[model samples]
Target chain A: MTKERKPKPVFIEGAISAEFIGNSIAKHQSKTTIGAHDIFLGQVRADQIEGKTVKAIEYTAYEDMANSKFHDIREATFKKFNLTCMHIYHSLGTVKAGEICLFVFVSSPRRVDVFNAIEYLVNTIKEQVPIFGKEIFEDQSHQWKVNS
Target chain B: MTLKIKYFGMLAEITQCEEETLSFSKGTAADLLKVLFEKHPILEEKEFQIAQNQTFISNDSIISNAEIVLLPPFAGG
Candidate 1:
């Protein structure tokens, strides 16, 4: 039987810390049924626009819609994959260029499930979610970021 | 009807506010866009999508008394 999972908040205030990521992995140790784990982390890139360099990214979202889309994605993923568990987190406010902004973790009983699930989750989040980012430059000017 | 319109990302920057309530006449989503375009002409040049009550709607969809959102191109990871 498929278990129903409640949707949890996914937005973090700033950068997702390494410590938090480590703790999440540690917490999954008790779930012995999972043998393979796949992790994807998205870091802010300091791209050069003209002569300016990006310093940080400020993120915003249509909260209600984004959350609903995330929930739908989660449901669809569970139906498509034979995975044990999954977690997704994205930054809300400003995150420095070198900091982490998005983290996706998926675990399953076998390696193939995790490998495929991680790709789907990350790609879907980028294409479907209503989150936006402002690429803030060092001189305080900014440009909107669009997924390629 | 008073429609609450919310703007996100670059749309908000162009609109100069996150949200505002406007008194709109009953019409389709395209009609509402005409009114918004007159007020914020720059918006016509930008690319975006429209959502009503958190659901994406096409241009011909009828507008009701509900929350509307203007969303730019998504950049999430």
Candidate 2:
């Protein structure tokens, strides 16, 4: 009998570390059937607004809805792409500028599937996910972030 | 009926609270907005989407669920 897969938790409390990402990759080594892998990392940019420099981003979410939407996106991606596996992670709490906030990993047996799948996944996450970011300036002022 | 409303992102900032319950005797999403605008007049100037039971709706949809969420522009990557 095939094992039923459960949805992985997408939101973590802080920035995604390089060690975590490296370990994720290492775990895939045993799955020798995958020939190509693609990754997308979204970093918090220190954006300057109105002459104020942002020092960190405090992330928040409609957690229930965001997770459901992520599940839908994952299912849709699997239906549309020939991906061997996929993983998505996003930060929920404060992440400083220059730290990683979002990580997506996708694998496929061929390179073309991964090249197109990564772009689709990234764009879909930006458009559909119910996650918010507050840009905190060095002076303690803050502004809400909007996707462009 | 009492409706549970959650405000997120910039909307939360404007509302100054994340969630609250509104005793809405009137029906549907538009009616709720009318009452909300009466309280938070500044919301009329802001752009957002209303989700009923986690599903987004436009104007004049009947509200069948108490769980409503106000979502501002999505900034997630």
Candidate 3:
């Protein structure tokens, strides 16, 4: 029989702090089977658009749908790679430029599994998830950001 | 059928509201979008994708009267 696992909630209120990420690593120390850990942190960039600088990104999502999509990604990663554990965190509100907005953590007993898994997870999340970001400008003007 | 339509990101800016229940008589996803276009002409110039009942659908897909969400290009990283 397959064990049913509840999907881990991934949305953070604002920017993901460095302390929280550190704590996540600390908590994983007890999982001795994990010999390697790979992490991907998405930091917001300050882009100059049409003579205006981007101040921050205000993120929003169809929450129920996003959560389910994340679960689907997790399942696919597990099926495609031999992983001991995985975690994903994404900011739901305003994240200032240079702050972390998305974090993906994966652990495996072998180094190669995590290297490939991280790239796959990040790309899939960007391409498949429904999360949206509004790039807020310094002067309060804003524009929608699309993944390219 | 009254369909619950949700707007996200820049699309919400065009719609001027996050969500609303619109009475849509029988039609495909594209047909319902024609109604939205009449309500908000600006949406006609924007790019986005449609998801019915949380699953992405093509514009020509038949509507099953489920919750429809209009998503602009994804920017999440």
Candidate 4:
């Protein structure tokens, strides 16, 4: 039996920009009556927790694991729902506060699938991927970020 | 065979190291974790995730005694 190849995680060190993600979304759109597109952009916020001001975010991942998870999620999503195309992009390395960290784009023939697909993609990424983010404070103190 | 195990975030702090390789038989992923957690008791209290050959696996995922990556709860956008 042939072994299946695992998918690769799209890793970008530093920041995620709207233009970069927008271009990726554009490529998936087809001329065939594609009517709806839904997008979710996760931006880092400069927040003071306790006594520290979060200055930036540093993201890292088990690349091999993250990519594999992405592929599985992609396949499962396609099977569970009908969709035209989906794209997921997340930031690696250092991302300053107020910069985007995660961008998810989905397009479909109708509006309904796009909404559901975006939510599913975002949630699955949060719940499944092995990517981690470290919150760097202005004072140089750091903490790991976890989705609540 | 020996496999590398990695720690992240708070788990890394608790473990006091980022990565280490330990010996194991050709066992499933769960078996490796059982031994690791026993040696590092803090892991038992914390919730974490596992990735075998860079792919995320459920706790019950059938993993051979190959290299695996361990991760804690991640916080990313």
Instruction: Please tell me which predicted candidate would have the highest lDDT against the true structure.
Output: 1
Query: Which lDDT tens digits does candidate 4 get at residues B1-56?
Result: 87778777677888897888888876666787799988798888888877766656
Descending-DockQ candidate ranking: 1, 3, 2, 4
lDDT-wise, the better of 1 and 2 is 1
Best by DockQ: 1
- Model 2: lDDT of residue A110: 95
Let me know the TM-score candidate 3 reaches against the reference structure: 0.96
Worst 10 residues of 1 chain A by lDDT: A1-10
Per-residue alpha-carbon lDDT of candidate 1 for residues B3-28, written as tens digits (9 for 90 to 100): 98899999999889889889898999
Better of 1 and 4 by DockQ: 1
Best of the two (2, 4) by TM-score: 2
lDDT of each: 0.94, 0.92, 0.92, 0.79
List DockQ for all candidates: 0.92, 0.89, 0.89, 0.61
TM-score of 1: 0.98
Q: Candidate 3 lDDT, tens digit per residue, B1-77?
A: 88888899888887798999889888888898899999889999998999987898897898986589899999888
Clash counts for the predictions, in order:
0, 0, 0, 4
Kindly indicate the candidate among 1 and 2 with the higher TM-score. 1
TM-score of chain B of 3: 0.93
**Per-model TM-score on C-alpha atoms:** 0.98, 0.96, 0.96, 0.81
DockQ of the two-chain complex in candidate 2: 0.89
